[model samples]
Target: MDLPNTEAVGAIVALLLARTKRGDGMKPWVRLVVPLCIAVAWVHSPALAQQPAKDPRIGFLWSGVAEAAAVRMNAFLEGVRGALRAQGDHIELVARIADGNQARLPTLAAELVAGKVDVLFAAGPAAVRAARAASPSVPIVALDLETDPIEAGLIAGLSHPGGNLTGVFFDFPDFGAKWLQLLRDAAPKLSRLAVFWDPSTGPMQLKAVEAVAGSMDVHLSVIEVIDVGNIEEAFRTAAKQKVDGLLVLSSPIFGSSPAMIADLALRDRLPAIMLFPEFAQTGGLLAYGPNLIDLFRQSGTMTGKVLAGTAPADLPVERPARFQLIVNLRTARTLGLDIPPSLLIRADQVIE
Candidate 1:
C-alpha cells in the first residue's frame, strides 16, 4: 500500500522532462509511466523482506565410551550451549558417544552424515577422521585433535582449511616433558618411570616422553593399556617392577576410567601425572595439560559460525591457548610425598 519509491520516481520524471528540450510529438507521459512501473515492481518485490534464519542441528560425537562419559559430555554440551548463546545462535544438538569403543565410530559417523546434520562436532583425531571420511561435503568442527590435521588429510591447511574440518589442535608436544618433570619434582628419588599408554593411539606420545626420561637418567617401562580391563594390570606391573613414578598418556580408555585409574594409582602408592584437570579433581595426583572445557567452548563457537554461513574451509585450525597444572594436595599427603613449595606455587590449581 505504501508506494514510496513510486512517488519519488514521479518527482524525478517530472524534473527530467522540465529540463530537457521537447522531442517531435513525443508522449511525455510515456517516459513517466515506464519509470513508474519499474519503481512499483521494486517496491512490491519480496527481496526486501528476507526469510528468517533457522537454527542449526549439530551432530556431536565423542571418542570416549558412551556410558563412561555422561558427565564429561554434559560439561561439553554446557560449554557449547553457553558459547552459542553468546554468539546468539540457537542449535539442536544430536549427540553420540563412542563409549570407548573405537569400532563403533565409523558406523556412528556414517549415521550422523546420513542424518544430515548442519555441522559435525567431534573430539580426537580418530573421530574427526571418521566424520571427514563419512562426508567430505558436510562441515566438521573438532576439538582435541592430537594428530596433525594436515598430514592426517583432515584439512587442506591450517590457515585456510580447504576441507570441512577446523578446530583446536590438542597435541601439546611439551606435554610429555612437563608431566615427567612434575613427577620428578613430586618424587625426587624417582628412578624408574612406568609409562601407561593406549596401544591404539599413543606410540608418538611414548617416544616423546621416552626421550625426556632418557635425558633425566630415568628408566621408563612402557606399558600398554588396551582397554579399561587392562588398566589394573598395568598399575600392578608398574608396582611389581618398583617403578617410582607413573605417567599416564592421553587415551579414550584413560579418560573414560579416570576414577578407576586414580584409585589404582593410589593403591599402588605411585605418584602419577595426567593430562586434564579433571583427573586431579577425581583424586589423581597431578594433571598438566590443556583446559579441556575451554577447548570445548572453542569448538562450540566455531560450530556456530559454520551454521551462520561461514564455510569450514575459510576458518583456520587453532591450537589451545589455555593450559593448566593441577595438583591434589590430599593425594600427595596420602602417598607420603611432600609437594615442593615451588611446584605448588607454580600450579594453576591446588586442590586440598
Candidate 2:
C-alpha cells in the first residue's frame, strides 16, 4: 500500500491524542473539524496564491501613417525595448496611425485604453492630447513634439508632468530662430519666405522667426495648413506672393505628409527648410531641427521607467540633447542653388 503523508498523519494524530487527554473538556467534533481546517488552509497557502507577472502593454498613437514616420518611430520604440530587455522586462507594443487625420486620434486613444494598455506612447501633440483625454491613470510618454507641452497645457510642467504624462520636448521656440538663419545662409538672396504652420501648435511661433528674419533682411508671411490637402495651395500662395523660400514648421498636419511636401517643394523650385531630417531625406533642400531619432529614443527611456514602476509624474520631461543641420546637395544641385560655404561647413549631414 502507498504510504500515507507522514506529516499530515502525524498532525492529525497529535490533535486526536490531545483531545483524548482533555476528555470531556473539549467537544469530540473539535478533533474532526480543526484538523481538516488546518489541512485546507495549508493547501491554499500564500505561495500558491502568487502568480507570475504579465508582460506590459505599450500603445502608440501617431498623427500620420506608421510607414511615413517609421524611421523615427522605430528608433524610439526599439530604444525602449532594448532598455527593457536588459532588465528582463518584456512588453507588447501596439501602434496606431492617424494618417494625417486628427479626428481619428481620440477614438484610437480610446481603443488603446480599452484594450488595457499599461502606458500610451504618443507621437505628436495631437496624439498626446487624445491619450491624456482617454485614460487618466495610464502613463503616457509624448515623443518628438515641436510645441511646449506645459505652455500648451498638455502637462502641468516639464519637471512634474502631474497627470500620468511626461516626455521629450523638441524646444521649437528656440529652434525657430536657428531654422530661419539657416535658410538665409542657404539662400542669401532670400528676402521674403512663406511659413507653413499649424496654429493649434500654440499661438504663432512667429516671435522667434520675426526676430531672426528682421535682422537678416528677410520678410515672413504665415500660412495655416490644418489639412494636408491644402499643402499645395499653401506653397502656391507663397509662390504667388513671390516668396523666395519656404519654412515649414513641424506640426501634426505637416509632419504627416513629408513625401508630398518634399515633392511639392521640389517641383516648385522652392528652397525649403523644414523641421526634421526626414524632409531633407525625402527631397527638401534643407532641414534644421532637433535630432528627432534621439527624442524618440529618450521617449523609449521614459516608457521603460514607467514600466519599471516609476510614476510618470516623478520622471521629468527631457529635451533633445542634440540638433542636426541636414543639407541635401543633390536637391541643391537640382534646384540650381549653390550651397553656401557656411551652410556646407555647418551641416551635420549632407545627403548627396
Candidate 3:
C-alpha cells in the first residue's frame, strides 16, 4: 500500500487540531472518523501512489559465434546471477552477437545502446571498441585479451579506470613470450615458428613474440587470420614454410575453433601452443595463458556492480588472477616430440 503524500497528511492533521482548539460543536467520534476517512482516501488516490520499479537491463556484445561461445556465455551469466542474488535484483539481458563477423559489431553495439541498456558487457577487443564507439556514456565492462587498455587509451590506469570502461584485460607482453618458451620446451628444435594471428585483436601479442624472436634465435612467419575462412589457409601457409612449431595468439576467431586448429596442427605434424587450455585439452601440444572462462565471469561480476549503482570510473580494472599450463602427452607423442619433465611438472594438467 502506498502512503499518502506528506503535504496532504500534514494538512489533515492541522485541520483536526484547529477544529479541536476552536471547540467546534462536533462529536469526538465524528472528528476522529472524518480524519481517518480522508487519510485513507488520500493514500488510495492514483496521482499520489508510487509506481513499481523497472528491472535493470544489461547489454552483452560478443564478437564470437554464439554456438561456439556457449561455455564462455554460461560462465558470464553464472557470475552475474551470483552477484545480483544478494540484492534480490533481476536483470534483463540483451545480447548482440556478431557471430565471428567483426564488421557487424558496430551495428550490433548501436542497436544495444539504442535499446537503453543500463550497462554493456563487451567480449574481445573488437566488441569493446565497437561498444565504446556506439555510446560514450554507457558503462562498459570489457573482457579483452589482445590489447593493453592503457596503451589503447581506453582507461587511465589499472587501479582506477577514470572513465566509463573497466574490466578484465591481459596486457602482459611477457605472457606472449612465455607461450613461445613453452613451445620450445616441448620441441627443442623450434627454429622456424609460425604465428597464427588475428589483426583485429591488435598487435600486442604479435609484437611481443616478434620482440623476442631474434634473441631466442627463432625465425617468425606471421600468418594473419582475419575471417573464419582464413583459418585453413593459415595452416596451409605454415605447412608451406615447413615451420617446426606454431604459436596461436589470442583472438575470438581462433578461440572459437580450438578443435579444428588442433586437428590441423596434428595433421601438419606441428607442435603447437595456444593461449587457451581447451586447445591443449582437445589435442594441441601445449596451452599456457589466463583462464578465459573465469575472465568472462569476472567481467560479469563487474557488470553487476554497474547495475547496482557503482560508476564505471570508480570500479577498478582487473587482470586474470588465475592462469593454467596444460600439456597433452598424446599430442606430443603423435608429433614425435617429447615434452621436458621440467615443463610437465609445472603444468596444471597433463592429458595423456
lDDT comparing candidate 3 with the true structure: 0.81
The residue-by-residue lDDT of candidate 2 on 1-352, one tens digit each, is: 4333322221221212122224323211111111111112233345554353565778878776444555655576667765565553345666666666666788778988997988888887678888889988888888746666777777787788887888887756767888888887778788889999876565546577877788788888888876666788898888888887999988867775777889999998889988778899989999877766677778888888888788888889888787788999999999888887877998899999
| Residue 35 in candidate 1, Cα distance off native in Å | 47
Error of 3 at 324 (Å): 0.4
Top lDDT prediction, candidate number:
3
Could you tell me how far off, in angstroms, the CA of residue 343 lies in candidate 3 after the best superposition?
Answer: 0.7
Give candidate 1's error at residue 119 in angstroms. 0.9
> Tens digit of lDDT per residue, candidate 1, span 1-352?
8655443222121211212234432111101111111112236656675454555667877767555444554455555555454443344566666656666678778877897889898787668778888887888998753576666677788899887778877656567788899999998988998999876663567777887888899999989876667878897888888888889998767776777778888888889988867788888899988776667777776776776678989998888887799999999999998999999999999999
Q: Candidates sorted by lDDT, descending order?
A: 3, 2, 1
Candidates sorted on TM-score, descending: 3, 2, 1
Q: Would you list the clashing residue pairs of candidate 2?
A: none
Error at 247, model 2, angstroms: 0.4
Number of residue pairs clashing in candidate 2, backbone atoms closer than 3 angstroms, sequence gap of 3 or more or interchain: 0
Off by over 4 Å in 3: 1-51
Clashing residue pair totals per candidate (backbone < 3 A)? 4, 0, 0
Predicted candidate 3 versus true structure: per-residue lDDT over 209-285, tens digit per residue: 99988899999999988867789999989888989889999998888888889999998989999998889999999
- Lowest-lDDT window of 10 residues in candidate 1? 27-36
